[model samples]
Target: MKKTLIIAIVGILTFSCSKKEAEKNTEKTDSTNTVDSINTARTKINDSIKALNSKNRFRDFSGSHQFVYQNDSSPKYSGSINFTKIDGERDNYTLSGNIKSGKNSVTLKGFAQVVSAKHINFTGEITQSIVDNDNGKPYTRKGTKTFMSKDDGKTYRLQDMVNGSGFVDYIDIHF
Candidate 1:
């Protein structure tokens, strides 16, 4: 009877110790997975910044793009914008293009300064023509725009815009 009690106590101790060890191991694994996920996200962002910095910001920017206005209810404007001139040393460029959607058209001429791999500041004048029914009127506006990339520089978003009136937000840009 004494031997059996001793054996039972030993068995319980062994089982308890093994269970505690298993829990510890699971905690370690969970912690490691969290760290790994964080590292992966960091790597992706870093890769995007590197890719953006390596390319000619001016050349790559010459393409057809779609701009969705934050405050407008109309569909997005699609057009071709080109950087006609660039100063590589100063990271400045001039762009001119026209974009249209429905009866609204915009002619834009602008200069952009590359602030970093992920950001660009633009100052431009836009001649916007809107046709209400059969009548059309053109208006000119000057503004400053800030472009920022969030997803590893795969695309850029127009985060802020300052015109004569005030600041505009939530304008999305796709390249």
Candidate 2:
């Protein structure tokens, strides 16, 4: 009877140890799978953010849009802005736009340097041609100003930074 009881206790201990080992291996596999999934998720999220930044940073300002000046809407000055990518760093761009209202017209040529996500420094010229010689004041070329996007990134608005802004409040380039 003593031998039988010893054998029974040893059998129970061996079965208990085997069961515990199996549970430990299962836990290890589960933890490894969880870690792998987390890493994959992180990589995908990083790729998405990079794509969005590239899209918003560089844009094609195509399609016709009205250039509103000093709340004037009698006859629309319609034009489109074009971007020629500069050869240097990614932040530099050659900006050009043209608009016309009857015989009067305007042309904008500038270098747009990105200052931040919300601002750009435009240093260039706006030349107004009055073919009919209208008596209205010319846009007197406020050559340098910071362009800000008023409607998110759809329209970039620039205004003269000084007083007596030549009857021009701002110009919206639907970039």
Candidate 3:
């Protein structure tokens, strides 16, 4: 009876030790995964910024367009916009500056984070009231632009424009 009890206790100890090691390994794996996710997000943000700063898009550009919100319920307001870069800045740099779309002028603030040379993410914020094209009155709403890019510093398209519109006009993104 004594020998049997001793053997049972040894077996339990061995099993418990093995279980603890397994749990530790799982924890290590989870930690590694979390780190990788964070790095990926940072890389995406950085790449987005670089793409918006491309000179090909902003090297003295002008265009007129209309925008509709969700549906055609809004009136179509037409407008022209111009874009130019600040003096002495790199071709592919962070974009946070002024823009003139139609009769309204506003400043743009942008955020970009990079995890590596390839992964990037970019976001832009516009906070100010501008004159409404339909009524010629001040319109108030915060605007944010977002996009993603894989290229080192090339073309970038619109990801999203959030919160704000007047007279159904397409946004002008120049410089």
Candidate 4:
């Protein structure tokens, strides 16, 4: 009877230990799955952000733009501006263009920061050179311009401008 009782107690202890080990393994698997789920969520969110940044409004503004000075109704300096390159992402972009205005023309290289879909701020250097009687003399000008769009970016009204030559009070720009 003593030997039988000792065997029964040993059996119970062994069963209890095996059950505890199984529970521990289950807990470990649950923890690992939770970690993997969090990592997957993070990767998805990061990819979405990257995709949104890649498709910005600047991409739509690429091409040749013809602009007329609204304030000068006499058409003193009507010009066609051609964009050669536009680079960057989101609301910030770097642009290079050639602007021809009557007897004066310049190569404009600039950076634009979008305050909103309807507002933009620009800083650029204008380099000009004389090639013929119609062209202006060689000169360089640095300028900052702020523009606001009243028609949902279809047309921009120049609110203010400051440059090396002087400050232009306000003018309208349409593309």
Give the 10-residue window scoring lowest on summed lDDT in candidate 3. 62-71
Best by TM-score: 4
- Show how many residue pairs clash in every candidate, following the order shown: 0, 0, 13, 0
| Candidate 3 residue 58 C-alpha distance from true site, Å | 5.9
Error of 1 at 15 (Å): 99
Tell me the TM-score of each prediction against the true structure.
0.47, 0.52, 0.33, 0.59
Give candidate 3's whole-model lDDT. 0.46
Write model 1 residue lDDT over 112-155, tens digit each, in one string: 77677788777997665545312446656678877798875566
In model 4, the worst 10-residue window by lDDT is 68-77
Better of 1 and 3 by lDDT: 1
User: Global lDDT of each model?
Assistant: 0.65, 0.65, 0.46, 0.61
- Residues 1-175 of candidate 4: C-alpha lDDT, one tens digit per residue: 9999999999999999999999999999999999999999999999898778666655366666754432211233445554333343666666555546565554656876777778877788656543342234565656877769989777766564332234242233455
Question: Order of all candidates by lDDT, from best down to worst?
Answer: 2, 1, 4, 3
10 residues in a row with least lDDT, candidate 2: 161-170
Say which prediction, candidate 2 or candidate 4, comes out ahead on TM-score. 4
lDDT of 4: 0.61
For candidate 4, give the lDDT of residue 138: 60
Q: Write the per-residue lDDT of candidate 2 for residues 1-175, one digit (tens) a residue.
A: 9999999999999999999999999999999999999999999999787655555354444334445432342345566666665653456678787877776666778887776655777889876654332444465465677878756676667756332333344466664
Deviating ranges (above 4 Å) for candidate 4: 42-60, 67-89, 100-104, 116-118, 130-138, 148-174
